[model samples]
Target chain A: MQTPNTYRAGPDPDGHFGLYGGRYVAETLMPLVLAVEEAYNAANADPAFKAELDYYLKYYVGRPSPLFLAERLTRHFGGAKIYLKREELNHTGAHKINNVLGQVLLARRMGKRRIIAETGAGQHGVATATACALFDLPCVVYMGATDIARQQPNVFRMKLLGAEVVPVHSGTATLKDALNDALRDWVAHVDDTFYVIGTVAGPHPYPAMVRDFQCVIGDETRSQLHEAEGRLPDTLVACIGGGSNAMGLFHPFLDDPSVRMIGVEAGGSGIATGKHAASLNGGLPGVLHGNRTYLLQDDDGQIIDAHSISAGLDYPGIGPEHSWLNDLGRVEYVSITDREALDAFQLCSKLEGIIPALEPAHALAHVAKIAPALPRDHLLVMNMCGRGDKDIFAVADHLGVKL
Target chain B: MRERGYWLALAMSRIEKRFAALKAESRAGLIAYLVAGDPDLDTSTKLFEGVAAAGADLIEIGMPFSDPMADGPVIQAGGLRALQNGMTLRKTLALVRHLRARDADTPYVLMGYYNPIYRYGAEAFAEDAAAAGIDGLIIVDLPPEEERELADPAERAGLDLVRLATPTSDEHRLPTIVKRASGFVYYVAIAGITGTRSADADNVHRAVSQLRRFTDLPIAVGFGIKTPEQAAEVAKAADAAVVGTALVDRLAQNLDSAGKPKPGLVDAVLADIAALASGIRTVRK
Candidate 1:
């Protein structure tokens, strides 16, 4: 397991992902944000904090999820050998729990009594609620009114765990709106509330801290692939929402010169057609949701609404680190249109006998386009970050077919 | 009939008087907001001069937040422009420090949301804001309940804490909110969010009259006091009118193709603001 110190937030005082990520929030949340940064700084170094999080990740969260070789899918594609980091098998059924467990434990250590989270797809909300239940802490999840209806099952799961889900009706009533509501709630209750932000975004320490916790997925993937294939993977692929799951799988492989990391974004219609959440493909450097990142914003800098079949991926901003990676040329972001993602969802299910969450299905869909051109001897690893069980209705509706 | 600095001079006079009696004034005072570093800080500086000239009472140099929930699109766009122009809280405070050098009597208020203040530590912020010539603070998000952490330190620095009282505040909470407030009470009227227009003038008059019963403190109503007509309706009951989103919206309109402030826009907005202030007179018994 990687040491907790491996992902320390600060050392970059200006909040940069190697010259990106700065405090871009409203002036109201600054002091609390500073407090959070200070708290994370002190807590990340404490042995007790490290040990407690390790216990949950191993015993409670059931981490170090297997990296399985998708041999048949690789053969069918006739390109690079495909490997899957099975985060879908993790407790709470996604890579989100890995982060929630880490944050909840940090919250307990900080002596914070309440947890607040914002969810678009509700995976983070469910994960936060689960952690709150385990620790007997009060939890409040802010979900966009639109998401409350679309991601109802996860909303139900959060409620079943005794978390109160607040429906945010402001602005487009989606992930960004939920984030606005969560910030409001945190500002209202900053004294005792620990905001368990679900992604690799937000101000300093959060982006860095969440990535550190989630890097387990990457660390495990690297070792598991090495054990299976006797070498590092030639290509790594993951979907980008706030880019958390992608960061988890990409962090360890970041320094590997031979590895080509690909981030697939939701191109609702297509980037060329202009209705998409493909920030890296079609975005400018702008400030939003706490950091300076690649954002889908207008020339005047008003954040543009994003569209994706997957509610999780329908955010106009990508993680600040992803912005830096894009700038550094370490990662290339590709867009997979809604039609392509939906087709990939069916193809993966039929050929691999695995139904991928629509978010990751975007990345899988990219492989269908990029893989055939690569040599068969090379290896490509895709993070099967979540399960599609939560997305059946959405995929069905998109196809105009009954579930 | 008026010189460029004529309106500018009126804004300066008000800023001077407000700070001179800040500590002694028992009736909570009014702090007027105009986006700092807006329309080029030169004009913003002149606008501050105009605010001082106009007997603004107290000055709240708004450090604009990008997503101003309570603000209408006009103010929201104004704030975005301010940020785009490289207007940071540090720079806004620096402008106040610049003002302090010329006229030391008028108290400056740094009114904004929390993010920028958080970036600078609250305790350290109080000290720095005081050093920068800011004499009061009104953070919209920091209510009485969340005051101990920020308000206590600010008060120690001799800066006043101006809290808001919305229409939704109940009788029990109103008094408590009033008791804790160090400066004038801000009464937000007909809020769904911000920047939207108020349909009725009479409703605003009635709301202001209702607020007067709670405290002897100066009560100002904001949220939709846009035009001179609206200000006149509010002036009947309220001690001062808060014209924010309206002023900000004007500046946003004046922005050029590159989003920079056009000088023509500044002059035009100042003319409108002058007309609005001149239109409303303090109500007589």
Candidate 2:
């Protein structure tokens, strides 16, 4: 088995982390993909690009988000010192802003006039629209009709940001369908459009580029934890949908073998009931989107609709880096059911005065499971990736609350 | 497994024979595409035979996927309708078998994304597809970089893994694409999904002329050849004009309000095919 240090150097020159990430697209989009790859590589090497990104992240999106010690939750667990990486405090109320800001800037640098993206939970859509609004670029977001109906606030939010939200109705009408629509749009308008894939999935350069952008979460967490606790945390936890937040937090800690990482997946109902979005936990390795990774697909390779109370985690496939890490056993992956996540959602609200989004609720649910068993001296940090404002209606409906 | 030369030789024989026949007649071939179980299997099967009888030289059967990222709304709807009516990879191959049972001369190619074949097991899919008389394949999402997964098995089964060269496939990438490409080269005239925009004939001619410098394989121009006029214009530049979304659109146009196939659906599809075939046949002269 490869050590954590060896795993950090992926996805190589061909954009592959073992057999996971590569450019699996049509011929018409090849040149555009290549151009994006070249531009990203040059920007990655340019110090001016990094300086501009740092400037925006610090002043605009409010980077270096706090790492707060959840004292009440720590007392409740009574086993480990619990700390929360407060990504929910960011401008877009989620870790998604970190990636969108970087991608929109890169798109502008490449002279791309239009920006396109796919969103499931509307957080990424809101963040992408926010960046486009700030950059004065035309933006279009493809969202599933089902998602649009459920996430009406984010829909209106995107429209308010001057983005045209196209509701895709084909093929299960979810994140996968929305992604398919976005790819079709990119293919149709390859000349002037830049597809800002929300997650760390998709073709070459995406898994890597999105990971690079999101590493800010882990980078800040590492420094912040050192300043607060005088040492690295013993354990790290984050939720995984297409696994952007998890990758963001885990990439910086990969080389630190002393810090164990756990990725929590949305186990809607349960894995046994076949109604969950636990791609790494329940799915098999297959090709989807633009990369080879773990996917929820049937015997005929047709992608199955993933079920999760949180639309953000309701995707059939995961990022290739997550797939590679799962294979390497560097990061442990587990599932938390909807009922458990709901319980954690309320627990964090009352105990820590934090109403986390349903996505991070999954991570809190997993924290509830193991936090009580560890030693009090042991330290655990969880990514509070999003706030619960957008999910209040869904949670209320699930809990049968009249409000 | 047969040697590379052996597989290439056998793969070219059938496809080359069709193109050679078209060349001798001083005209281009009209390739028609249809979702295997659009609306339903029986109607799609009827449309398949009707297209061949209506003068289409080659048939491209679309194996509908649940998620077709490379397709536009029209073809995406067609696939959804097919899946709703019970379209599976196994059923699609069976449809090809049924078509090949009576008509043995025309060439048949299976085109779609790779997930279904990967799910069916690549080796088994190759065996079944070849046994069902599939001559070539054009997996839209599987590029040359990721071809090893299915290409080797398909070629071993004597099925041509027909590769696509697009408007964006620049001079540097064309060699790698045409290297393992068999049967013929599918030149996507537009840099977009199916049925969106028309391809300029001048650009199509220039691309085909450029591609001719790399390989001897017959080139087929597709994607946005919607009208008979557009098909005829494309045929003047390429060996074949492949039309898919236009045919799918005709199927959609003749559908009832409930999304069921109307009575004139087959007639409408066949009429469109006949018109396109006529336009393509008269192109060179």
Which numbered prediction scores highest in TM-score against the true structure? 2
| DockQ of every predicted complex | 0.06, 0.76
lDDT of 2 by residue, B14-56 (tens): 6777887888899999999999999899899889988889989
Q: Each model's C-alpha lDDT? A: 0.76, 0.92
Query: How big is the positional error of residue A206 in model 2, measured in Å on the Cα after superposition?
Result: 0.4
All candidates' TM-scores? 0.68, 0.96
Candidate 2 C-alpha error for residue B282, in Å: 1.8
Please list the residue runs of candidate 1 whose C-alpha ends up more than 4 Å from where it truly belongs after superposition. A1-11, A26-28, B1-29, B32-66, B69-285
Q: What is the TM-score of chain B alone in each candidate?
A: 0.83, 0.95
Docking model 1 quality class: incorrect
> Total clashes, candidate 1?
31
Tens digits of lDDT, candidate 2, A84-199: 99999999899999999889989999999999999999999999999999999999999999999889999999999999999988788899999988998998887899999999
